[model samples]
Target: MTNWNATDLPDLTGRTAIVTGANSGLGIATTEALARAGARVVLAVRDPERGRAAARAVQGSTEVRRLDLADLASVREFAESWTGELDLLINNAGVMAIPESQTKDGFETQFGTNHLGHFALTNLLLPHVTGRVVTVSSGAHRRTKGIRFDNPNLTGEYSPWSAYAQSKLANLLFTLELQRRLAASGSPVRALAAHPGWAATNLQGRSGSAVLNKLMAIGNRFIAQDNHAGALPTLYAATQDLPGASYVGPDGPGEMRGGPALVGRTAAASDPAAAKRLWTLSEELTGVTFPAKVKTPK
Candidate 1:
């Protein structure tokens, strides 16, 4: 993988990709990279005007589509209206360490938007997806033990970081289980996961406090990598010939910033039992199930 980078992505002449939250940050970077490699990329965003504007910035073929991950109706609407084959689906949109809030579905904001929403979207669009699914997780997934199945929404007492960590852990778990199901069905489609590792992006401002947002901005200026650099792992996970369920991230000190490389996840993130349990819960919560067959454990 020497000299591996976005510039090295294979020709995607007939490929089509959908990138959620493609209006900015790593999403935009991922979109541009794919587009430049000759893929038709869909910029799926909550704001149509912004998505159109972001689509204009890409050098190659692109389109803009309305998608609000916080709303299940919107997720279904986006999937229902889509047509044709999808070579890639990048579940890139997500909220960060925000104050306790609920999505329109009454689920916790971070967990709902970051995990459940994408879970539903991927399942809904699976038939259209022929190539791969790349989910953006986080190094912060190590901050938590596992999904809070008993109280996923953290209804009683909530910590912003804890919720975010749980959501990220779910991202990895979903990838693992999705790959398992796809393989069980004898499908070629792969599911992979990646983390940005402290990239500087507008995501920092999502937290509820303006003062904290300002502090994050200042701190990121000195510590985080640019969005393009932070996006390398995602680009790698999306286009690379890696094995199914591989986790990609920066290869640097503390995985903060560097070139893309295969990375490790917490043991809890690798727990097949937890992944299966979460997958069952996700299907119940989202009301969307994959066509792929999943073997029940003995």
Candidate 2:
């Protein structure tokens, strides 16, 4: 298939989009593109100041809202405070290989913030949303053997990379499961997953190893693509009329780094059994059930 990109998006004049971790980097680029295409974008950021500045830099109007992915209560609070229809939701904020930490909810940082937090947020916001959603994942997901249902929090020896990998895989699983539920419930909204390849983002700021951190630091000085270029896949996933549950990444190289292009594939990403297991576990853990009214529109 030819690498797909969205240079001209469908008009989204009256739509409202909420993008998490959108204060800077790829999420900011996604916000810019979405706002430019006519949607009223919300920068869901951890820091309000950074988010406000980011909103100002984007091409279209935007609002800055606080959201700490590590805090379950904050997620619930945000969802509870929100009202009315939501056209797009982009789960874009995440952390990479960092030393072990826990959120306010007592969950491990990587799985807790990256996967569990998003999981709770999406579920809590599900009823109010009436359009498409794009979940940001990573190719590193393929590097993981699979998710550990027994210990998703990595209570054992925690390798930051593996933790990040598992979280990304969760993103894919969440996207697929969400779409299945939407189709089953007859909702018009869609769920899609995307990756930025190897764009230069601040995620590496907290590398677990000094050596790896040094290498990444040196690499960003030359090879890593800009945040704008890295945001393409996410923007495409959020705005395109593509099929639900599809994965988007760079179309160039080993899908390491490039513009917003449809690329990358993983058999594990499409494992129905794994997705269903994750879904069940997620619903149980979050105490949020999928919408039961999914039926095809007449």
Candidate 3:
């Protein structure tokens, strides 16, 4: 995986993929690449017009669908309306270190949108997934200790960076437990995670601090990679024939920017006990449970 790029993607003819937040940033780049490889992609976004605009730029088969991950009702609607096999689910949409806010379900915005949203969506669509589920995590996961189970929403003691970190950590733990369940159920589907080093995107402009946003803008110009480069890890994790629970990131120094490769996570991210606990909490929070057995794709 030294120099793997989007052009290296396998022929995805006849496959179908749903990419959350596919209207912009890494999500759009991923959608373009997959579509170019002959996959029928769905740009699942909160805004249908923007999704359509983005889809128009793509050269292959694509459709736009509304999906507000911040709401459980929307998540259920998106899943319940699904009709056939889903080859890949790219859980790529997320909020960064923005001001503390609650999702429509009243959970912390970062944790809810980044982790719980994908958690619920994944479980709800598990039976239809034939290949893999790729969730986009971040290196910022190292900033926090771990999930705040006692008060996951960080009710009164909320820090934007810390909250974002917790949600990212949750992404890894979710993958671990998801892979475990898939294996135990004798399913061929895999659960994987990826991070886009430091890609320049509009996500930095909404950090809720003018000074921080300006600083990130400067960094975006000089220190970060482009959308295509930043999207490599996600593409690698989604398409490669890697092992379940594999985490992919840039191969550059500090994993900031480079080609995709298997990367290491913190000990907290690798904790099976924490993974199990988080899975239980996620089920309780989302009221979505893993199916007893995932149907094998025929």
Candidate 4:
């Protein structure tokens, strides 16, 4: 899909989308584009006031919902309150390479929020999903070897970049397994992944290193694309008629910036065995399992 952009999104009338972390950065841009395309967009953020503020800027049917991916109780509450069909679920909220911290559930922050949180949420709401599930991954997934199953939380040793990379890799693997399950269940839903590829967002500022943050600030200005451009791949994956488990990213060099297109992932990300193992671990950690039957919306 050369030269494809958010402006090329199909008419999304009557659709409903929930974009986590929709209060800022690529999340907000994605919400705006989907709303502009006539979808009823939900700004799912941890902060209700800020979510409302973001929602006010959107032009279509919109609502603000509090959802803290770092907390499992909040995720369950959000999913329990849902009703009817959900056409799109954009798992966009995530923490980057920040200080090594634990989520409320005691899991590593990056893995907990970026992968497990969305993993639990998606399975909880799978029955209502009629269209697609798009989880935002990252090119940084290539930096790490694979999931640290022995000590996923990095209990004894923790590196910010490694944690982030593991979480991003989990994103792709989750998509892969989710699609496999959906297909096996004979469901119409699809699961896809996308990456912004060096998008200029406030996420870069919280790497927990002053020197690195400053360097990233400089790179954000020169090397990164704007939020709208960064959001193209997510939008494309969310709305396009692509294959299950497809990964979309920019078409530019190194997938840093350009139009949306199918992109490759590391072998670790493409391994079905690893995908299944991660899925099992995710369900065990979150206490959320894939639904035995997915109810399709008529």
Which of the numbered candidates is closest to the native, going by highest lDDT? Answer: 3
lDDT of 3: 0.95
TM-score of each: 0.96, 0.93, 0.98, 0.98
Off by over 4 Å in 4: 296-298
- The whole-model lDDT of each prediction reads 0.93, 0.83, 0.95, 0.94
How many clashing residue pairs, candidate 1? 0
For model 4, residues 1-298, the per-residue Cα lDDT tens digits are 3888778889999999999999999999999999999999999999999999888888889999999999999999999999999999999999999998999999999999999999999999998899999999999999988999999999879999999999999999999999999988888899999999899998998987899999999999999999999999999999888999999999989999888999999999999999999999998999999997795534
Task: List the candidate 2 regions with Cα displacement exceeding 4 Å.
Answer: 1-7, 292-298
Cα error of candidate 3 at position 67, Å: 0.4
Model 3, range 116-161, lDDT digits (tens) per residue? 9999999998888999999999999999888999999999999999
Worst 10 residues of 3 by lDDT: 289-298
Write down the RMSD of all candidates, one decimal each: 3.1, 2.1, 0.9, 1.0
Q: Rank the candidates by lDDT, best first.
A: 3, 4, 1, 2
Error of 1 at 245 (Å): 0.4
| Model 4: lowest-lDDT 10 consecutive positions | 289-298
Clashing pairs in 4: none
Q: Candidate 2's residue-wise lDDT over 179-263, tens digit each? A: 9888877788899999988888888767768888889988877888788778888888887778998898887787877656666
